[model samples]
Target: MHQNNLSDLHRFIDRPTSTWSGRNDGAGAAHRRVHQAVTSLGQGAPDSADAVFIGFASDEGVRRNGGRQGAADGPAALRSALGQLALAQGRNSLRHTDLALLDAGDVVVSSDLEEGQKKLAAAVRASVDAGVLPVVLGGGHEVAFGTYTGVADSRTRKTAGSATSQQPGRLGILNLDAHFDVRRAEQPTSGTPFYQALTRERAADTSCRYTVLGISEANNTQELFDTAHELGADYVVDEDCGVLNQQALLSTVREFVASVDIIYLTLDLDVLPASIAPGVSAPAGYGVPLEIINVVLKEVAASGKLAAFDVAELNPSFDSDGRTAQTAARLIHTVLTYYTPLSSAAPSLR
Candidate 1:
């Protein structure tokens, strides 16, 4: 069934307004301005552009947590924060000459697990068909299934009519999180996306190779590690790496990116130390510092082959004075800057 009403899905902000300077001043000005801009621009017409950033905040699983009900508001909050940073960083000044962006709104999911996945898949497929790179923001890690499904669908279409056409190259997943998130989808929660992606036929056919970084020993079940090995994932445990600084992490990520055709980045905020991102679902005691995360993101963006990005598990309700949101906003800004490419002087990571 066609979910969104196409007529209602027109551009959010058709013409730029003079009053609407897409700037993120310190005040909530930028946030409100972007909210209005996107709200006015609305959803894009189907298959509409060269590149797009789709934000999905899955709140279905969050209902299980008592104080985590506000995860649904994550996409908006992250966008607001991103808007402020974009304004501060003058992101509008760096829009790619050839690439246009559309903020495809969140997917409408039903209570039933299968139904929700189906809805999410359809939304992702629509974005792909339109030739948009969907940058998904999530309510939980389970959102990966929907995001990956979108990319996989595109690959499937390109190979569908050809008898001898080889499958598309592997999707390099740079998953920066505290836990492996390889739990089986017995019930389809935040811990299950990677497992489902590896185990399912559609996703497996895409030959998705995962690079799981910032993993805490405490969170890794033997089964998760065993499954990761069985599935051929480059599992990097934080302890085994032994005192890795920011530059070292960037190098490692660069090596991983070189090994794949397209990159899909998924960041679970819990990967950061609780002191930095206390708003996440499961804050690790000792996690990657915020600076290291930024460097990794910069390198990933500079790679120039980033297919999509997802920032997930941010619980604004738990954020203290929006510190976590601010941090995430900065990272998003860095990503945009890395992808923006100012001049010929800019180093190419392609």
Candidate 2:
């Protein structure tokens, strides 16, 4: 909350003065890009917004998992790429409807991964409690654990002592990734976030549904598959998410959405082909196509159940020509364009 001291904002490098600058068409606000519409959080601004961007600038999880480490720089890179893109101009756009966007900057994790996760949870919880969608940019898939904790804690507080106290609504996680990310690690790592999430929910006796799309069979072992099954999680393998199976792939996503009370969508770039998304902790040998991924993203956004969103594993060290960042930005852009806030579409526990 260092609203005045920019450099100490998050214990890392302060947010750049204008990390989100782009073209000026000079045709007025309609012609403005994303950079034009976004405001920083904690600047004597309104308490609410349509969506807020929070960066988790930490790579400790990846380092623990024995993966490449540059993802700590992912948040800034994503902002740079997203800034230049034009805001969607149709009636459905958040900006077109006068809703606001804000950037809260990053939660820097210098060493203690667990402490970093706790800090992230607090930031995300604040946004959700304010009825704003928290669009988190990741340092690794470990971002999933913190994001889930924040959203889950918010729900718990919202339902406490209410008529629905006996039944906190089901929270469904739809992960678009190449790995199941449910490995049982001694400590939290890039590969253990989902496992942490599921265990936490179960310990609290809450309803949680975990589903994964674009899982690469070769990347995940049989033990991981067994663990998913044992935990009542569902997943669609990468081979089944190909262009030839577009209808089925979308159907699966829609069904999962319909079955859950709310959705937290997390996209891991490694779900796409290595050639398409080389900037990841682990590049996919054979991955889902971006077209199919985008279609599924649109479906989830339109479902009116999405409560939060995050993009993981964008290691710029391996990216070519900024392709991965651009792609991740495009997906974030798509979700913002079509997402129906739960407040408008449902009971408004989000």
lDDT of 2 by residue, 1-350 (tens): 10121222243323423446888887666686888768875453444467878898888999999999999989989999988888656643332234467788888887789988887887777766666778999889889898888888875334532374577778999999989888998999999999899988889888889999988889899999999998898999899988999988777876897887778899999999988888888999899999998878877876767778999999998886999999999988887766677645522212
By TM-score, who's the top model here? 2
Candidate 2 residues lying further than 4 Å off, grouped into runs, are 1-19, 46-48, 90-99, 156-165, 346-350
**Each candidate: how many clashes?**
10, 0
- Give the residue spans of candidate 1 off by over 4 A: 1-51, 62-69, 87-100, 155-165, 201-206, 239-244, 340-346
Model 2 scores what on Cα lDDT?
0.80
TM-score of candidate 1 to 2 decimals: 0.77
Please list the C-alpha lDDT of all candidates, in the order they appear: 0.62, 0.80
Clash count (model 2, backbone only): 0
* Candidate 1 pairs with clashing backbones: 11-41, 12-40, 12-41, 12-42, 13-40, 13-41, 23-87, 24-87, 47-130, 58-139
